[model samples]
Target: MSTSFWILCHDLKGGGVIRKSGSIIKSIRQHTDAWINVHKLIPRDEERITEISNTRQRMDYYEKAISLREAEDVASLQEKLGRTLSKAEISRIGVSKLRLFLKELLRKRYMDSVPLIIPLLEKEYNNTTRKLNEINRELSTLDEVKLKEKGRAFHDLF
Candidate 1:
């Protein structure tokens, strides 16, 4: 049977159904002849920012399809697919554990599509970190905040 027809027969209007469809989508390339590169389905751009935005949109769509919110193995899943895409509290967690969390998150989030999207995610992560550092640098240059922290003991150390 065609993948579309099979999906049509399955009632996928609800969140639960959508998740099931997602799991089926994951298993398709493995269990059957169906194989797809989500990257090819998406539009590409020359500019890195545009490319990142488009990739992120597609990622969001896939994320919705296989949302970990209702997974049967939910207990084993990490929070927010273990993605601290913007801000990772590195100081609060173990480095190896965080690495494991990221690895698992990527595995679950992208699965077979990781080859196409890993570079995008990596670039996006680097971009996010760069922008965050820029913001922090700008904040550090502010005289008011510096003055406010003058008397604090651990402010400089932390």
Candidate 2:
């Protein structure tokens, strides 16, 4: 049977006993194509997910350094002032000021490396965050593509 006849028969508004062999085959092909495209995306998604995980690990390491350095600064500040400080008080003064105060203390005590370490940690943390955001955006695009293909296949059935 001709494809045009099958299409015309399927398109009839009030047809009874209309055959849809061609339409069914087309729908099946769409579904198969959708499945294949989605499967092709799987390895790329896995690699991006792994990259995100590694980026998060890098972010966590930088965050840990920030926390440790901040905590040490807080303890030193508290000890120097001979008083405990509230979290609000510590935060209100800000990290840069706290680091500066600690730098002065370290300078007086002849210790070194606070200035170098803080900047490096901040830069690394920011870079990791940027990388993570880019990866997430790419994954979102991939998911959107898969969704579009799946929608096309599903809706073509009717």
Candidate 3:
């Protein structure tokens, strides 16, 4: 049971923020029972993650650079960043490039269907929370027994 932490940023209008987030974390924590923290970003960071602001402008600049085959400029930019972009990083950027693509492909009716995804997410969170509570209870019991044993050993020595 390997546990991996995820930083999920969900759109606010979808509703069930507490239930969905809590349940998913709860379910996973049950199996591997790892630590996970889920948080809602402020509007500014949300805009940055969703590429709704200056981040979008930076993305556009990079996309134009790639399309033009401006190798020297790209190299300079990469050097300034102190690291080369991995394929995964580039793929993520390409996905961001598809924001407009999704908007164009999905009509208002389809956009309205987005809330359907929340239930599955909520179930996952609930299960994880339950498991975490079970694990915590077991640990508490073990600690109590250990403390009692130590007390008896000290009394016997006296």
Q: Whole-model Cα lDDT per candidate?
A: 0.47, 0.53, 0.55
Model 1, residue 59: what's the lDDT? 49
TM-scores, in order shown? 0.23, 0.26, 0.26
Error of 3 at 3 (Å): 45
List model 2 lDDT by residue over 1-158, tens digit each: 11111111222331232225445434544664311111111221221111112123454465588788888888888999999998777873535355446646777666466676889999999999999999998887787778899999999999
C-alpha lDDT of candidate 3 relative to the true structure? 0.55
Candidate 1 TM-score, true structure as reference? 0.23
**Per-residue alpha-carbon lDDT of candidate 3 for residues 1-158, written as tens digits (9 for 90 to 100):** 23233334555632342355567446555764455444335333332122222123445565686666545545665788899977654443433346645555665757777698678789999999999999998887787778899999999999
Ranking by lDDT: 3, 2, 1
Error of 1 at 109 (Å): 13
Ranking by TM-score: 2, 3, 1
TM-score: model 3 vs. ground truth: 0.26
- What's model 1's lDDT at 12? 26
Candidate 1 Cα outliers beyond 4 Å, as residue runs: 1-112, 145-158
